[model samples]
Target: MSALFPTYKRFNLSVKQASGTTVEDTDGNTYLDFGAGIGVCNLGHRHPDVQLALENQLNQYWHVSNLYQQPIQEATAKWLIENSTGDQVFFCNSGTEANESAIKLARKATGKHKIISFKQSFHGRTFGSMAATGQEKIHTGFGPMLESFHYVPFNDRDAVKRAVDGDTAAIMMEMIQGEGGIHMADPDFVQEVAHVCRQNDVLLIIDEVQTGIGRTGKPFAYQHYDISPDIITSAKGLGGGVPIGAMMAKKTLRDAFGPGSHAATFGGNPLAMAAAQAVLKHVFQDDFLHGVTEKGRYLQERLNKSVGDLPVVSSIRGKGLMIGIECTEDVSHKISSLIDKGLLVLNAGPNVIRLLPPLIVSKQEIDVAVQLLSGVLTDEKASIT
Candidate 1:
């Protein structure tokens, strides 16, 4: 009787309420939320600041069709650009839409059609982004995907060099490949990519949809690498819970699109803007981001200790709260075991257990997650024999 499509593997739990780092199911069981709504709830569920901002905006207006210039939209864009260290922003409704806008702007800017994307990288679910996404599974049914998009292995400087030609419009990449098993791009590899882009006069578009908004300890993952992307796409953590997406570009690429070139109906609504403004203001504090670094280290160290002796856990990867644990066994079963034990975790692919705890989550909560995961993995190993 469900009206929704059968595309997603549905979870059985009926979540009724969520607060801080825990979600209460309709059956009245509370579960620790380490997934953080796939990185969207970066500030945790129903944060006071975000809640208050939305409440005030809700009383005022919800949607305005992007005709009259909204002040909140201007404030949000200014906040994002100031934090982003870029020239401008193109607002959208989701990560895929933001990426689509970025790709289109890149192509239009360079006056070329081909885009160079990397293997195992995920851009988005839209046709343009789907074609830009390196994984094949996302493109199975979408017949005749956008042509002129090419993929190369990640971290391969020479392969990227080979892929870029005059017809190539831009090179798109994610700093920490989210769905591609939480792999961090090598710093040297990033520098070389930037060099290639500069030499070829091609744009460098970074997909920060998962790695932005202080998820990776810094305001952005690229900040850690000290590399500048000509254009950047962001979404997941920006709204603190509300839906919002944006594409930021340096001055050159910012001027690519003229007035009528692109648009989104709900791109920068007042309510979403208010929520985003709160997120940027709260997370941009030097003290909060510093705490993120400390908490990230604490969590990672604890996980290393708990899962160290197990042969099944191949590696722990990623930065800050955007961590991934690569297990030797199937990740889905492990995720289910963790969920059964009152800890909510997510599987990035077949073997990577992705953890995107809310930035406000404390060491105490992290300890609970680590202990629960340790117990589940231990029981799983014992049962295997």
Candidate 2:
């Protein structure tokens, strides 16, 4: 009976409000949010700083075309470049657009038609991005996907070597495969990939949409690998809850995207820029990133100690707050039961329970979430027995 498209199999809860690490459903039920809006609200729901920035920007101006000079956009881009390996940036509205931009830029810069992406990698849903995504399930109905994209097995250095050819423009991958069951890329594999790209004169594009903006205990997850990517795509937590995405590139590739080469109407709008500026200002701090690293370690340790012995649990993996608990069976029922227990979670695939708590979540909240999760797993085990 709903007017909305049946795209998502939504939960029964109607969240009316949220703050920090909690959400209140219309029926007045409060749940500890471990999903953090699927890694989009890393600073937490309606963070005061981001909210204030939005309010101030609203009082000033919301939308402006790319024809004019926008100070806020410039400042946000500067912050992003200053904090990461990129020297220039292209602003967009979502991860898909950012990736789309990166793909086009790579092709233009190298004048190569083929792009090499890893299997189990997810770039985005747009035409170019969808083609870049390695999962066949996502491409099932979309026949005749865009051409010139080749997929190599993830974390397989030799396969990557085999996949790259003279026509290859770029090699794209996620530092941690969020949609692919929270799989972390092996450090050696990543280093080899960077080396391969360099040898082939192919650009290295890292999709940080799900793992960027402090989700992985670093300003950008690629920083952990110590490899320099020619381009990086980011979104998710960039604007806190507001929509914003960016495609950052090294100075060498910046000229490829001439003024008319790529553009987004609302890409660097004042509102999103304001929100992003606020988020960057807070998240780029040494203390903030250090806290994320500490919290990530804490969460992983707690999960290992509390549920490691559970018959249903296979492993707990990931970096920073983006942790996943691989279950022996589908976690749908367990997720639902946890929801009933006032805790919210997400699934990386069918069997992995993905937890993306906000960067600001307290240790107390983590303990509560873990305790609730333990209870749910225990009850499910009991039912099975």
Candidate 3:
């Protein structure tokens, strides 16, 4: 009997060990990992730098409550601020908490209540974040959602313009809808949203939980766009596999979140901070992100060549390492076929196959992924040999 809740559609394979882009099942089966723990393991499993940092921090005092004023937290926060528009940051244990914090802070800071989010956009699972999410299915069993959130179609400039009014506190969205089928926000649409926010005194919050921390070949996916967000919520790839989340905002709104306003017990654990510091070092490097961009182009090109014209495929989208292959039909069986062929990938929804390989994954590994996709779509044998 399983003690866990019947929540996730648990995969048959049990991961016993993982390294680089490879995962070994409990029964001694090996698979090339392309999901990267659903885009959390951006540096791949147990990256040497991140692993060493965690090990050293583990030897040190691992968990100290926020009262002690940890300098490691300052160091990590500075990295985020330096690379983005945020002047201050708050840490938490997961994306949900970070976003929840953002919602609270935005309303408190602006002294307004209503928030505008986009349809098909996912923020998180908490009540506040859930209320902000545009998908109706996520709110089905949760009973009446928290009030004062409005949803508009993604990339629809006029809907966003119409949604924002004097009562609206902020506008929250994702640069790429990672959970909503890997849809990228149009650059022009982003500019228009920012303009609307500026004119209406509305805070623009970008949820980077799945698209931040170099997931989109940039420090944050919003960096690719022309405008910057008033606040940013980040996680997933932040700690290189460790659980950590952050909500960053400009200095103008700093006073709103006065002491005792918001807090997380495990927010800045020494070990998670250590992991984040190590991750930031590599991600902020001169050519590290450039490499990811190159690899993304290569991966997309290969996918286009291999299965772009297949009858089952509809389109290939997303940027950086966060590519999605949209199919005309359900892709559950195709994903199972890839897993059987020793290539581990995941589905974004029912019909979109999402690929999020670790930034460190090489062209050869990408080739293996393409071969698996090709073989499965073509119904042929896919062999590493």
Candidate 4:
């Protein structure tokens, strides 16, 4: 009997320690962390630079209410705005909070209550973000939700065009839908949405929570499409291993919230900003992102070649290090079986096994993971028939 809440389906292992991409359990068994805490640990667990930054800041101030302007907060805000096309920022404590800010900003800026989101898209779990999210299972039992959120088929510009109207406040979407099974939105579709927002005077809000800060081989995934969103929300991977989130906007939307309208106590504390600043410095480097691109191609090519003949493996998708393995019913069960051998992975949806490894993960680690996955998949297929 556990004392904790029963809502979270807990993992059976009691992890004692971790370094880079591996976690050591209480019994001294080491497991490779291919999941990266559901795409949070892009730079890896307790990176030396991240650790040093957090440790150095611990001796200083940890919490200061958002009333006073903090130096590191200003620096982080400037860094985020300068790195992307954003003009200002609103700091928060998690992806959900950042997304809530984005939603409120979008509605306040446009003065329209309705929002347009894509099918299978996930923003966050908060009330506003949860309403914007397209999945139904997550919404069960949380009824009478925020109304006027319209959902359209992803990658279908026609559906989006047909759905937009005068009441549409913003067209919010994930550049690459992460939790919705690693689906990639077409560049043309993204450009169309941008055009629609421009023509209708609607704000474009991008949820970059999972794909930002060099995770997709770019500072932001929207950069790949060259579409400038009016508002953007980011959190995962920004603070390396620390907790942080941000909602950025253009100059027009920046003034949507008055000082009293929105605020968070620990939104941009000194220590969290220090960790994020260090991560941004390293992750935004041209050489580092280029390495991610090369490694992405290498990993994709290896998987495609190795599993090309496997009947159970359907296809591999996604950009940069956020790759997904689409499997037939036969190969899906093999993922759980591979866990027994110490390699940890995740399922994006029911049929897709998602892999979000550390950006610093070596080729050898990926090779080992792939090799182990291949063996388990092969054995499972043999037994299925």
Candidate 5:
């Protein structure tokens, strides 16, 4: 009997410690981690730089009120602005908060109530963010959801065109739908959305909670597209495992959030800022990003070559390190089997195996994961046959 709430379908394994791309359980069993803490540990667990930064900040200060000016916050925000598309940022504690802030900003700035989101897209779990999420399952039992959110089919420009109207305040979407089975947005569709937002004077909010911070071989996944969103929400990898999320916006919207408009108690605290600074310093490097791109290609190629022929595998998709393998059968058992075999993976939806390996994963590590996955698929195919 566990004291904790039964929210998550708890895995039996207990992780005692974790390093680059591996985690050790309480019984000393080690497993290669492919989920990267659900795309939060981009630099891997306890990265030396992140650890040192946290230690240094610990010796100085930890928390402070948002009323006072904080240099660390300013520095982190500056770094974020310098590397990405936005000029201003609002820090929060998680992806959900970042998205919530974005929604509020969009609504307040435009003085409009409606927001356009796509089907199968996940923004967050909070009230506003949850409402923005187009998936119906998450909204179950949580009736009376925040209204004024319209859902259109993803990658359908015509649907988006028809969906947008005078009441729409913003267009929010994920560049690569992470939680929705790793679906990649069509370039044309993204461009069309951007065009519609601009033409209608509606804000475009890009949710980079999972695809930002070099997760997709770019500082932000939106960079892969030519479109420029008015606001971008980022979290997962920004703090390198530390809890931090930021909602960045263009200079034009700087006045959107006045002093009393929105604020977070522990948004840009010293510890989180230090961790984010270290992560930004590393991920902003050209060499590191280039390596991510290269490694992503290698991983994709290996998956295609090794498991693409397997009868159990339906398709392999996604960009950069955020890859997904769609299985013909339910992936719940497959994930558990892989975990038992010393490989930890994630399930996106019911049949898609989501893999978000740490950026620092070596070729050897990737090869090992692929081989293990191959074996699992082979056995599964045999059983089905």
Candidate 6:
């Protein structure tokens, strides 16, 4: 009897309000939030700085034509560029749109039609970005997909080498396959892919949609490696809860995207830009990211010690604050159990329980989440016998 489409498998709990890694249900029950709105609220729900920035913008202006002088948008773009090798940016409404723009930029800049992406990698849901996604299930009914998108095994440099050719426009990839089960790409493999693309005049597009904006203890996860991508697509945590996405490319490709080639009506609206400016100002600091890295290391160690040997747990892997716990059986029930027990978590693929806590989560919070997860997993192990 719901008016909404059946696109998502909705959760039972009604989110009435949320703040700083905590959510209150309609019935007044509170839960510690570990999912962070699928990594969109990295600074935690309605962070003070972001809230203040948005409020100030609200008192000024909310929307305007892209043709007008938008200094806020330019400032937000400068923040992204300051933390990346990219020099130019095209703003959009979401990660999908950012990725869609990346696809277009890659093809137009290189004058190539085919694209190389990794199997199990996820880009977005839009046509161009969805086509770039290598998962078959996502493309099940959307055929005939925009053609010439070749897929290869992730982390297999040999597969990538065999797949790239003259017609390849770009090789799109994720640092930690966020939606594809929290798989981490090897650093050497990433560097090699960048090398291959450079050698062939193919652009290297890094999709940092899920892992950017301080999600992985850095501005973007690609910063963990030595490779420099030709383009970077980002969103998710970029606006710290507001809707915003940006596709940044090297200055060399600026001509390809000339004013008329691409755009988004509400791409860098004042509200979104204001929110991003606050988020970037706080998260781009060295102390903040260092805290994330340390907390990530601590969380990994604690999880390994607590649940690594559990009968239901197959493995625990990932980097920074993005960790995944693979189980021997389906984790859907366990996830529900955790939700019922007052902890909000999410799944990556079928069997992996992905943990993406707010970057502002403290060590005490980490311990609490681990204990809750450990208890549920222990019970899951007992039921599997």
RMSD of each: 1.0, 0.8, 2.6, 1.2, 0.7, 0.7
lDDT of 6 by residue, 224-342 (tens): 99878899999989999899999999999999999789988998988999999999999999999999999999999999999999988989998889999999878899999999999
Could you give candidate 3's per-residue lDDT for residues 1-385 as a string of tens digits? 8999998997789989999899999999999999999999999999999999998988889887999889999999999999999999999999999999999999999899999999998998989999999999999987999999999999999999988889999999999998899999998999999999999999999999999988778899999997878899998899989999999999999999988999999998889999999999998875999999999999999999999988778899989999999987788988998999899898987899999999999999999899989889876222211
- Candidate 1: stretches off by over 4 Å: none
Task: Write candidate 4's Cα lDDT for 5-51 as tens digits.
Answer: 89875567788999999989999999989888888888898999989
Model 2 lDDT tens row, 174-258? 9999999999999999999999998989999999999999988899999999998899999999999888999999999878998
- Candidate 1 accuracy as lDDT: 0.90
Candidate 3 is scored at a TM of 0.98
The 10-residue segment with the lowest total lDDT in model 2? 376-385
- The 0-to-1 C-alpha lDDT of every candidate, in the order given, reads 0.90, 0.93, 0.92, 0.87, 0.93, 0.93
Instruction: Give the clashing residue pairs of candidate 3, or none.
Output: none
Task: Using TM-score as the measure, name the better of candidate 1 and candidate 2.
Answer: 2
Off by over 4 Å in 5: none
Residue 56 of model 1 has an lDDT of 96
Ranking of predictions according to lDDT: 5, 2, 6, 3, 1, 4
lDDT per residue for candidate 5 within 1-385, as digits (tens), equals 8898999997899989998888999999999999999999999999999999999999998876887889999999999899778999999999999999999999998899999998999999999999999999989999889989999999999999999889899999999998899999999988889999989999999999999999989999999998888999999999999999999999898888998999889999889999999999999899999999999999999999999989889899988899999988899999999999999999999989999999998889999999999999999999988
| Model 2 stretches with alpha carbons more than 4 Å out | none
